[model samples]
Target: MLTEKQVVELLETIYDPFLKKTFKETGAIQEVKINKEKGLVSVKIALAKTGTAEQLQVQQTVVQRLKDAGASSVGLRFAQLPFEEERTTNEPIYLAIASGKGGVGKSTVSVNLAVSLARLGKKVGLIDADIYGFSVPDMMGITERPVVRGEKIIPVERFGVKVISMGFFVEDNSPVIWRGPMLGKMLKNFFDEVEWGELDYLLLDLPPGTGDVALDVHTMLPTSKEIIVTTPHPTAAFVAARAGAMAVRTNHEVVGVIENMSYFESKTTGEKEYIFGKGGGQKLAEELQTDLLGQLPLGQPDWNDEDFAPSIYGEDHPIGKVYMDIAKKIIAKLR
Candidate 1:
């Protein structure tokens, strides 16, 4: 006879497409009943939606995995995601930095942009919504965790910007294994549980791709705006358009698109190198009916090692000037 625990271990292999997580991680498995004599197993799962292709796939996977676990037959049922009213806020201007695919330096743009806004004497709060691949802490050189007081969390302050990320909660370089529902809950806590004082801007460094977390933000923050980041590579622009389309579909105002790594400048000869190609940002903006906010150069910033901060160029640095200009435009739009 298969034990309930064994059945659970087998079902853990099944992943939800939207959540990008296992049933076990999402706490979707509400119950597991087994009939030892009959060698039958029954499972109840929590899902965001029912009777969909993905959900049907999950159900089929459960049946096969359970049968492989020695059950003669298996029964599965799904319960919709528990409905809850998440806290809502309309005080600060919420800006989400999003990308169609990962590894285009979205987080780097987020960290620097937030810092740039703060540099202009604006109170900024940044949320690292990329739970699975969180790197904001390391990029900002944040070693300390968020301090808890009563039921609220105090965000860590760095370079004049207040920051909170999954990096502060989990072990260094550890993975965040959670389901879609959990991701929504965690995002809500960032607004409800964290004591974010008055701010001019609350920036969310969204995860790559149009996943559950991004959907949660879209649904939760109706007034929030978005900034799409993409590389100069044409293929990258194609993918980034999906992200921009999602923003439009969600009815979130797209502040603009920032073209990263548009070109590399030769130090000695002062010649421009379009290493990743050019016009991707402009193409994306035209597709989305928006403007290309700014084009960023590929280079490293000069940082003070004693602070252990990422390469955030000051207003004097060329890259820093670009960010400052973008931040000013965003401020103008918000105000």
Candidate 2:
């Protein structure tokens, strides 16, 4: 025979796999009934969403743990909490990466940043919200299109990060010639139709400049923050400032600036050549009142034929280490 307090102590050790919190912390164990004579124990629990594999796992674990704790039989049942409560408790942080112009390695930085964050044990999703100029799929080497599960689009997972891109929908690299309203609608669909299951972060790779798609993203994600990307070129930094300004105007926090291709490093000599000139990233960060998160050197990544992503480096690679450091700083800033 176990006391109610001891039963709760046992239940506290059981964690909800999806929420990553113990049952006691989640207020999941609503009721616990025990019958010592019959060796029966019953628990009523609350779940954020019902009938998912995670919920089923939680139930199974609960029953097994209780049985192991001395109950001959355990009865379990679940009631779903309000939808609003669930969403409010588990909303993901949305971060958009932007540049004032193209050819600054914005998409590359976006892919690697998302991947790096995922490597750091955070659930991450990357949206190629570049719309007409979408290149996340190409840079990521993603060829498979997203799958439609019922009404929701399942984002393709690669390198431990979930990804959705317009490239998956285009035909033969044909241009997306939709008007502004159509573009907005498509961007809306990416958010509304895609089934991103409880991400820790959602990174939007916005098209360079304050274009239709960029504006749409600003409007769609009013609470979203931004990371500005630029090269070390003076002209490039000047243009990137405009993107940072737009983020400010839209009330999005400028988390930091990443200056890509800041230099080229010689492998044998171990010397850094400032091919693009220097100080652009620092200048932009100063102007935006944010940190210069990182300066990425120029070096083509080694590709594997079997891999589906480009510009991806392992955590130990030089560029990969830079991105991981940036990811850590970004996480700290967000916190």
Candidate 3:
């Protein structure tokens, strides 16, 4: 016959989801009551939620552990954990990559930054709020639709990060010409219906320009921040600034700036070429009073290819290195 001490030792094997440790380590399993005369063992396993899959798995595991520990009869009881109130804060620091024009590589920068942040182990989620121009699904190479569990919409995981985009719903190159209210409903559904889980950063790949889409996103996610992307040129900066100004109007913070296709490095010459001219990023940063977050050179080799996702970074590529550096800078700023 198994003693109470052995039962306690076996209960220690269960994993605790939140603490990411053993049940005994997390105090998830409280005291064990043993009735040797009746050949019965009753275990009280503290639960963090009412009906989570985790809780069900925990119970199942408890039964296995109890039997394995030599219990003739076992009874499991669950004690519900008190729910903690969510702390409301206005500063969620949602960084949006946006521009007043398309073909500015806004989505490219956003996807890379989100991936970079994930590589640094920060809880990150990327939303292709661009709706019509939802390049994120293609960029991230995620084809799976979100899993719906009751009221919860589990986000799609790609590159170790949660991502939601319209590209999953629409066909390839299909135009999404939906109007404001309809698009607003979908955007809000993504926010209210989808469970983003806990995230340190949520990078929004917004639609190009200060359109109705931006207005809707600002309404849904007011705590979001904005990151304007432009080329190292005057016209792009002006248009990109307009997008940033729109963010300010919507009460979202414009955190920083990113300049893409700012320059190119010649392989043979080993020299940096200011292909898009200079000072545009610094100029835009100064105009917006935000840091110049990053400057990306023209990526030739990592461009659209059949081998990999279009916006994904090729390992050992220089542009890929720049993304890693930018992600570190973002972490430092957040810290």
Candidate 4:
């Protein structure tokens, strides 16, 4: 059986997730009781907010630590902190890349924008919030999975960007069969459970269309800014306007519109062909009352076997330069 002093010392290392401080620093461990003969321990904790996912995480940590310290069982109780402490941690700018429909290269745009921002020396993180159709990990050529450190999941870093995706959790390219509530819970975990160190921008690659997951993100990050992606086709642009409207309804500032696959350029003749039609990007931007950020030409990235990412474009590639300019515009608008 452990003594009360021993229990207190052991719990001092546990952190209050929201406060980002240890139990000792916050004095959150209000009471500790130890039943010596039965080796049972009970502790009462105080946190900035109770009954949250963070609180549940803290409870699990407390219980596990007590058991490891020779307690047969652990009982935990939580209460809201009496006084709110000013949070000193800097929150990252939340940006969501969305589209009104699928097959518009929304994920491709998302992956490159994150890489472009990182290339510009901005600390960036990307979340594959398109839960049902997660492709970010493979798109970025991230082969490794996130590792658990204490109570937090450390995001995988690639190209100066920290990334978390549902693809890392599933095996053998299996399908996710979860419902809405479960998907929302997993998305919340991406925010609450992942350790994204100081990030200038945190971008969410939302599922195309105004659906449940998108709605959940709008609800969760009330101040998130959104960018609508569309092709130059009239139909694609017409559908994309609905996504912009959804962002407007949620009070998310529509940063700008990006027209992807606007045209195709010939390698031999150096001639440009308006393959998908023209002016759709401008039309959507006008509808959303925002700027037309850029029109991307249809082109494939020059692949490097050494560091091969299927969707990412190099900084010098023509399309890559377009993305860089778009990234700069985004930084300017948001900052």
Candidate 5:
């Protein structure tokens, strides 16, 4: 027969798969009582959530480990812990890549940053939360819907980064009319349904400006920060500033700013040209009191250029170097 202390020692070695913590560390083992005379040992355990296979497996493993550790008989049961349902605060930093204007290359920045992060050997995920104009599938060259396993939806993976987008669900030529509660529920499903596992960063590509979708994200991911994108054109910067300020109001920290279409490099002349005025990026960052992270050129206007694929799937292109620099700045700012 085993004492409660000995049983607990063995139980401590069993870890919760999802939470990535040992039972003992998570306070899952509430108490251990060994009724030596009755030849039974009972464990009161707390689970992170209801009906998670991983949690149930941890419970079963605890029972076996306790019995194997010398308990004559074992019983394991669980109750929910109120606060454990939130994603581990230890999980990777989440950054929302948003723009105040459409056609500013926000999705492109999100996709490239995700790729750049993965190239640095960090596990990364990109969530295309822009329901109205989802573009991740085209940007990533993915055509398949996510795989469904048990209760978890596995994001589509390519070039070492995992991606999930509404583009995978709705019609190609058609637009989604999801509104109100339905929209919120569908977006929330991405959190609960997707098996993100562990990641170093998860970038959400939000649609332009203050809108219903942006509001939903702020509410759901209260800790997520924002990175506003803008162009060098003054008015665009003015509008982009509103976005940064809105993020501040929502308690989402503005990590920095990105200026897309800041300049164009003449392919033939090989000279930098600010086709769209100037100073918008720096001006926006200055007003927001944040870093002017980087400027992305209007490189090869058609992303479908045969050369672009190599950049994503292969090692590095000159454009890849630019994105890598921005990725470095982003990681530094987040830290």
Candidate 6:
């Protein structure tokens, strides 16, 4: 069992996310209770803000730290502190990669664009906002999970990009059965509680269509710029326009459109095969009143068992160069 004084000392190291001050400095640890017989510790804390994702992070940290310090159980309560102006941090340029329907390679576009920007020496962070269809972690070959330090969840870094995904939280590829409100809360937590550090760009890989998760992201990031993904097929591009329309409705700038699986290039004859048809990308771009970012062909990345990122393209790969060009266009447009 731990003493009340010991608990206080432990908690003093934790800081209030909004206030940016330790519990000791802020005098935010209102009460501490310890039960020796039960080896239980209970604490009541106040922060500059409550009922936020930051509060939940602080609660988790307190519970985990007490348990690690030999407490069998821990309980925490939170209240809002007296008024103080919350500190502000530099916000990154928000970019959301969305598609009207799945199987159009939206996630593929997102991962590649994020990696390409990172390759250009830009600080980038990726949020796998497709809670129900999260795949960024596996696509980026990330084998590690984010760790909690103090009160913030540190994002996992790979290919020079920092990333957080719903895939990390679920076990054994379990389906996320959460409702809309719950999913929205988790998305908010990703933005508010994750320690993204300094980032030039933060990319969101949204779920397909105008779903709840997509709506939540639009509401959360009103200033975000979006890139719609579609196929060269006319129907695919037509459906993709709906996503672009939603972005427009939410006041998000439609930066461009990317037509994926545009064509396959034969290795033997080096001929271009328009498998998904053509001109859909230009039509969509024209309708959206934005530039055609790039067209990606149907192809697989050269697999390397050693590094082993199934969906990522090497910088020197032909398709990878196309992504780099699109990334450069994005930088120029956004800047």
Q: Which one is best on lDDT?
A: 4
Sorted by lDDT (best first), the order is 4, 6, 2, 1, 5, 3
Candidate 6 residue pairs in backbone clash? none
lDDT of each: 0.86, 0.87, 0.78, 0.92, 0.80, 0.91
How well is each residue in 1-335 modelled by candidate 3, as lDDT tens digits?
77767887777756554333456654666767888898899988765554676678778878887787678888988875444311222123577778878888998899888988888888888888988778788777766788787445788988877898877777667888887788888886676566676688888888899887888778766777788888998888888888888887778877788899998888899799997788888898898888998899997546554446777886468888888988898778766
Please give, for residues 1-335, the per-residue lDDT of candidate 6 as tens digits: 78899999988978778654578877889999888888879899989888998789899989988899999998888987865433343458999999989999999999999999999999999999999999999998999999998668999999999999999998999999988999999998998778787789999999999999989998888899999999999999989999999999889999999999999999899999998899999999999999999999888999999999999999999999999999999999999
Best by TM-score: 4
Model 2 stretches astray by more than 4 angstroms: 1-88
Candidate 4, residue 44: CA error in Å?
Answer: 8.3
Lowest lDDT block of 10, candidate 5: 306-315
If the candidates were sorted by their TM-score against the true structure, best first, what order would they fall in? Answer: 4, 6, 5, 2, 1, 3
Per-residue lDDT of candidate 1, residues 1-335 (tens digit): 88888877877646554443456656778899999888889889887567787788777777877777689988888887654311221268889999999988899899999999999899999999998888898898888889997446899998889999988888757888898999999998888678777788999999999999999999989989999999999999999999999999889999899999999999999999999999999999999998798999999988778878775677788999999999988888778
Q: Which residue runs does candidate 4 get wrong by more than 4 Å?
A: 1-8, 13-15, 19-87
Runs of candidate 5 exceeding 4 Å displacement: 1-90, 301-315
Scored against the true structure, residue 120 in model 4 reaches a CA lDDT of: 94
163-280 per-residue lDDT for model 5 (tens digits): 9988888775488887667767778777767878788998899989888878899997899989999999999998888889889888999988999888878878999989999999
Q: What lDDT does model 4 reach?
A: 0.92
Q: Report the error of model 6 at residue 102, Å.
A: 0.5
lDDT value, candidate 1, whole model = 0.86
CA deviation > 4 Å runs, candidate 6: 1-88
Query: How many clashes show up per model?
Result: 0, 1, 1, 0, 0, 0
- For each candidate, what TM-score against the reference? 0.73, 0.75, 0.71, 0.84, 0.75, 0.78
Pairs of residues clashing in candidate 2: 140-309
lDDT, candidate 4, 24-70, per-residue tens? 87788899888887778989988988888778878887888889988
